[model samples]
Target: MKAGREKARGAWQLSLPLMLMITAASVGPGVARADAQDLPIPCANFEITYAAKPGEVIAPTDIETNKDSFWVFENSGGNLACGGTGPFTCAGLTVTVPEKDVVHPSTAKTTINGTAAALGEQDQFSLTSIDANDVTQTCKGTYLFHVSSNGGGWGDPHLTTVDGLHYDFQSAGEFTALRDDRLEIQTRQTAVPTAKIPITNEHTGIKHCVAVYTALATRVGSSRVTLQPNPNVEESRKGMELRVNGKLVTLTDSGITLKASSGEQGASIGPAAVGGIDGHIKKAADGAIEIVDARGTQVVVTPQFWNGPNVWYLNLKVYQTSATQGTMGIVPEGSWIPALPDGSSLGPKPESIDERYEQLYEKFADAWRVTDATSLFDYASGTNTATFTLDEWPYNSPESCDVPGQTPVQPTTEAVAQAACAAVQDPKEKADCVFDVMITGHEGFGKSYQIMQAFKPIGTGTWYSPEARPTKPPTHQGGWVELLKKWWWLILLLIVGLLLLLRKKK
Candidate 1:
């Protein structure tokens, strides 16, 4: 009896720990681990000093230094420079010239540290000077300089004098090494006491001008750099051209505007004029340009450019929540008619559809592609009474759905269904037709099914599927499999309790 009691005690002790572990696992806090790539890389800060030519010194009052002004750069493999060697090349140094200053208006410069570093063809750098009258003059040149390991020393000078003002700029800064292939250098004016530079505007004939200037630099390729005026301080004007992916896009005071390749006015997207409405454009994950308007309308434009004899056209797909309210019709290449303020057309009447059945079928197919049941139903007639089966249909082969280089299989069954609808003789009967469509190849499965649906014409060019307009609640299929799936946990608990009871009896 003593030995049996000891054995039972041991079994209970082991089961307690196991049960505790299971309980803990089921009820413990859930913490999600983030991907290493998603974590931000840490960065270090450093100070920088600048030396200006004797007469080109800035004022001390305008100079402000803080944590925000510190240069930020990423380190590559724990090295200060990208390649982890001596003499790294920094490119694309953009300088912003302050307004109300008679001295330096704006300047851009590039610096090379190593002798082997070469500038690429795309690198652009320049310096501009504005006189008392606001007249502007620019000089283009390259500046080469170096700093010691301790961040002290003035290197060679690239000097330029414009309108009796001697302009010379030199820089020295401490480099902070980072984990990624990047480094940050912070530099302040050493010789100059302040940040404000006094200048005269030659264009406006204004004197005693104190202008503000800001500078930033970005590395390009291995050695080449292109510099420009600071965009934060300068306001984007009506005619500013922004180069995006080798194409020149215009920026206006209102918003960004895109022009067609044929020089025609394209789409102008900006903040919505209506209250409680907003509109914006963004790049999609698939590399398509998507524009969303205030009314919840979306227009997706493909990156593929269609170059014609005169202009370039982009493939566009427009979507709206309401089919009747926001319907888009395809217009011919050059048949755009300007509408007057009083609702009068200024050009030829709208083109008439010769193949009405084909047009209706296309609309139906489009609605099906997007899984818009309401829109699909709106294309049928009111009197036609039939049930329509709404289910997922594979429009492409599994191998070619997302794979490159393979053409996707089209939904030929939809075409076959449309052709059957078009074969009706009487116009009235054709407008109100019934179709039994059988579709196969769903998600690469060869399963085929049929759906009996009736369509009726609501208006001259409008049709709707009557199956969607049900007067009563639809019936649903239910069985033991579904009930077991929902209550599986209860059955599992019962089995566990039974096993524990049997073990205790033993």
Candidate 2:
């Protein structure tokens, strides 16, 4: 970019006339007429920057007049182009030039000192720019300019000013009196704006609005359930209980109780219950809940927003712990989807109500249940060489699936397996539960071990079948016994009477 300064043949033709007019109107003793020599190049300054996303903006600041002279520079990367749209525009000092060479003059109407300024019909203004993001290209585009003039002020670029550069810049890089002096300006290309990530909740029937704050406390869905600010009685009062899967939970001042599971409210279960964590439990003072596993690991939950009634944002976290360490991770919230009351659903089928849990169970159950080296590798969220073997079957049967891991303190395998199976109605679901029960024994083992077992590995010497086959018939079937026959003579007489009546009728 060069300084907008150069003498033209018509410099005097344009300036001389202006100078004569100024002198004729002037009564000063020794004031000289304006001339190229009288007024040196206007020193100016420029600023530039870029924002690469929609709703993002970049504008130059600290603008100085001709005192600071230079073009604001910006680098446009390959495949990138830069220009202002909407409220954004290229603005600077205004300069006047002949209507014939004014470079894409804008026909925008405006009032100067309460008088409408008429735009000339001649195509005087011109603007150009090179494109370099793609294949070989140079400045080859032109755009119209929003032109305006004041007694001696900035020439406001109207909203209509599009892409490309405006040349007719005054000595001060602004719109001012132009006296036939040629000006050349150039602008480097820059990146265009793109879209941004949206924030939303994924667990429940609540909508959360994201805002900037000094600090944000959040949890991943993999962490244990944590409630903030012990559910304020008032706030919690308005809160309806919902199953983790969004089943309608009946609410009471005591706490949200699972409606489907009577008396199993958050308040009903002991702190040790795994699935029934007190979601509304809060910190003593901070109003945050920190659910820690036996390994002293904290659970972090993600908020699942409910789009139904647009209630409060709900977050959930699950924690897995070992003797030495525990870990937590975020559960991603799905795109905004409608949520219905517990047991009910938003989709066409009621079965879709537990869609997430069902989907996740299917996706992870196989990996979680396989306890061999290969199974571990298949589902391992991390790398560990540990292997697992069941001594006497830690998990109760599927029916009592909620029973915790056996450590001289839990129920039998049959009980837990029964519980798990009871939770589902489908044969496939029961099979999955049975499978889960078997894998629980092999849990830390690598998948290779599982493959070695022919994928039919047995646990605790107990044979758990997806379908229970009856071994023998019931010997104690205690219903009503049959009676012996005793009415032979009466039956014979009834038959004889029936025959005689048929013969008489014939």
On lDDT, the candidate that comes out on top is: 1
lDDT of 1: 0.23
lDDT of 2 at 110: 13
Per-residue CA lDDT of model 2 for 1-506, tens digit only, reads 12212223234345455444444433222211121111111111111111111112222222111111111122243211213321213222121211111222221111101111121000111112211221222221111121221110111100001111111110101110111011111111111111211111123211111110000121111121212211233554343322222222333343321112222222211112233222232221122223222111222222222222122232222222111100011111331121111212223222342453332222222222322331211112342222222211211111221213322111125455555445444353244334333323211111211221221111111111111112221112232210101333444455456545544544
> Clash totals for all models, in order?
53, 88
- Whole-model Cα lDDT per candidate? 0.23, 0.21
Q: Which parts of model 2 are misplaced by more than 4 Å?
A: 1-75, 79-356, 363-506
What are the TM-scores, per candidate, against the unseen true structure? 0.17, 0.16
Give the 10-residue window scoring lowest on summed lDDT in candidate 2. 151-160
CA shift of 252, model 1, Å: 32
lDDT of 1 by residue, 181-264 (tens): 111111111111111221222211211111011111111111111111113223322212223223344333333222122211
